[model samples]
Target: MSRIPRLTPARAALAGDAAAAQAAAAPAHDADIPVDPQAGAFFDCDNTIMQGAAIFYLGRGLYKRKFFSSRELARFAWQQAWFRVNGAEHAGHMADAKASALSIVQGHRVTDLEEICEEVFDEYMADKIWPGTRALVQMHLEAGQRTWLVTAAPQEAAKVIAGRLGMTGALGTVAEAVNGVYTGRLVGDTLHGPAKAEAVRALAAKEGLDLSRCAAYSDSSNDIPMLSLVGHPYVINPDADLRRHAREQGWRIRDFRTGRKAARVGIPAAAGLGAAAGGTAAAVAMYRKRH
Candidate 1:
């Protein structure tokens, strides 16, 4: 096993609030647990590790490719913001957004999207890689923990990012494929909310990993099922509802946005501002829908 570097005082300070909350809610356990003799770490993509959803950025990229219309991109961004605020009530909207997003690339070769993912990963995502989250993943890697990127994004896109991050595996929502071409329809589970937990369980079982000893990190309250499955659950840069739950449940929280020596666990100011701005845009559209 490689030696995992200790967290910097700045990083440790950022996690202080979360550590305290966890200590109050439940006993603190080592985040660096050996699930198996060979197993490493399990990660949730989106806000947990990355600054934001890579798929969303990918959608923007598709817009640049002329695959998505300006109106459609606006709508997609609207639904995402609405979903983040309203939680599960926006499930239908999320489904519709995904359908529309995928419809934009219908009949396009998957290889083309794969190439786009490479560009997004290199240009957009590489710079936005959260340092604290990367450090956590690196710690797991050094500890001989096999890392996996589990997300609700399309499997092909997830695989591209996972490969770039050097993860051992990836499990994401599967889209239909016929004769090596995308049918632009989801063939299996959507891999969100509860489905994410189920997929993680399935992976653990397949890899002979002990779920009771494994660690899971996420940012949404919707991921409670998966977070509960692991022995150590670190809630990183959680949303409003998830932050409340994390406080109540004693989940550890880490704030990576502020690089400040004393940042708290709740949403960072920039993220809150972005969500507000995104929500305002969604509200305008939603109002237009009502009219």
Candidate 2:
């Protein structure tokens, strides 16, 4: 929420278009990463792969471009604070965020949004990644397993993050688009909870992957369905529910907070550590700007 020069919608659209073109023109994937056709690893985005939600970064980018008003930004910040404090996804919070996002992009060109997402990743997301989780992704790539990011964030944002991280690909909420224009509608349910499991199942079938040979990781109990689908399941920086569940199920658990150790770290303590590491201070500064 640091004040940058405001952009008119027309200027922002043009800027976004240019950025999209640049991203499109770049290399698509890392050719050096070997791929195993029958096995793959899936990962969650928010809190699992990164410090905060990718969608929140997207909202920051859009707000800077003046896509929404200050009030909307405040609402977005409040929702983000809730997520940070709870360290879990709430149905009501996701719905409110989804509705607000869809309304903002209703008449926009798909390419334009993609373009802005590229910049957003560089500006707000690059430094927020969890090194431990990233190392796990690297381990998968080294083992010749296909790596994918599965999240409820828009596909374009997921795509950008995956591409930058040199992952195989990503699966995310697909917004209905026609002739390169957003229709403000979703093609199916957001890849959340059961929907995430379904998407992974469909992908496994299409890719001819053996589920028992695959792996999955997440931080929330909400992703239990998807995690349960794979033979190897790992929990990274898990929430309270997921931590207890992982303990009960005897799954591998790792927490990359301050001490950078593998243990049953409480989410509240993790949140406090994350804040001490700058997350809370940043949120406070953002909130103060509004007042």
Candidate 3:
């Protein structure tokens, strides 16, 4: 049997001194760590792992660095706002927001983007995690589950977070690049909605995983397809629509936003997610107001 690995948000982060220590300590940072079929848990990023979208976190960092004009930031913010609120039902909004996010990175070096994401994560995202979600990741990890971050966020950001949290690896939207230079386009469709389900399936096939026995978790209604693809589908901090859907479909639900930190986890036992929506509170406020 493959041995279980240590996959928790490095204790330093959990202790509140998080940021630079975790990333620098993870050796599996950018590599694609293979998953073992016997045990695996696929987690959606953004609101599921962290408190908000990784791209929004990255965008704010870029804006502070003067990487883009205020006008461009405004435009991106608008698209992101629409995406955050209506994305579950409006596929078009996410597409537009993703396109704009990719365009913002066009002409930038992949290496530079990595550095930026790292810095952004260190100073911002590392501490913005939802504790309940972290607990879930820990549950899977301690049980020998190869937890993977499945998100529409860029691979760099996803990998950074996964590595910091000591997860197996990440499957995210791939931006086309050559010789370390971005091609200003995606290699394929952004890994969102149905694409997310497809990515998980492809990964499962490669990892020899039986999808029927695996677990998946997410906060958006847009992830319904991905959620449905697994045996244990958890609706974490679900939006209203997703909450309603979970009730109707008899899916397990955990709402950290309004309820007490989620108790009674899957296995091995762990504390629930704490409310850290305030860590990324500023950006989230903007998204809420814009919508």
Candidate 4:
């Protein structure tokens, strides 16, 4: 098995870090050092492992079940598209998506949501996963390293995706529940930006992981904080902002989206389909409001 290598964030910011990291990863005597038990791999779900947003996928599933109206779906799509275009999340967009999602699940049983998420993953998300990113995840698992998914989607949905992918677990936004039903409220802030970093730190503490030996992968610049906390930071299928940041930081980058359309839009290939399904240009109004 390949060893889980280490590279400090301070060094990684330097141009020479790439060569240094590669050299450190494969030594003269490969068998002398084994993968560290304390090493872990943390990946952002949206656009990193999957092609688009997990919340958007969950919303689409709920819409199919008549949990929400067409208008609501349109609005959700707009928020997600706006996020994709900007390469980071907007506070207002997140609030709207969170409120809409929580409201739909307010009186529903948690088990029902889990079941729906499972079906959604099989139908909508299974094939949408980026092959390159999935390969990296498999590599980590093969190396005996624990792998976790960090996302802003509901904890249940995130758990379902992680379980399906055979990952260790997930860290996601927690919605309050009572008597097995959603309460239409969140336990704390949504897992985005600095919140993602906090979640990673807490998970590392609980899992006894050494941040200096761990790795983090994401597509958005919003994940910089979380990426900075790890020894190996990789930007996968990065958005424009993240692409720029990754270059500046000298971080490793992997883009799985193919062809000119993906290059032109600087987003996942599924985004065009998502936008079309969300309602044409009418939803652009919703995107404007959030900005």
lDDT per residue (tens digit) for residues 108-206 in model 1: 887887888887776767655655565455345434456788888878778877665545679888777777677888877688889999989888888
lDDT of 4: 0.71
For 1-291, candidate 4 gives per-residue lDDT tens digits of 332332221121122233542343332112333545688889999888887788988898999999999999999788777766665556677778888998999999989998999999878887677644554554455345678999999999899887755577899999999999998999998999999999999999998999887889998888999999998888887888888988998887767665222223232111012222112122222222332
- lDDT: worst 10-residue window of model 2: 1-10
TM-score of 4: 0.76
* All candidates: TM-score: 0.73, 0.79, 0.78, 0.76
For model 1, what is the alpha-carbon lDDT of residue 22?
26
Q: Compared with the true structure, what per-residue lDDT tens digits does model 2 show for residues 139-168?
A: 454344677999999999999988766577
lDDT for 250 in candidate 3 is 90
Residue 255 CA displacement from its true place in model 1, Å: 1.8
Model 1, C-alpha of 198: deviation from truth (Å): 0.4
Model 2, stretches more than 4 Å misplaced? 1-35, 261-291
Alpha-carbon RMSD, each predicted model: 12.3, 11.8, 7.6, 13.3
Predicted structure with the largest lDDT when compared to the true one: 2
In model 3, pairs of residues that clash are 131-273, 132-272, 132-273, 132-274
What are the lDDT figures for the candidates, one per model?
0.63, 0.74, 0.69, 0.71
Ordered by TM-score, highest first, the candidates read 2, 3, 4, 1
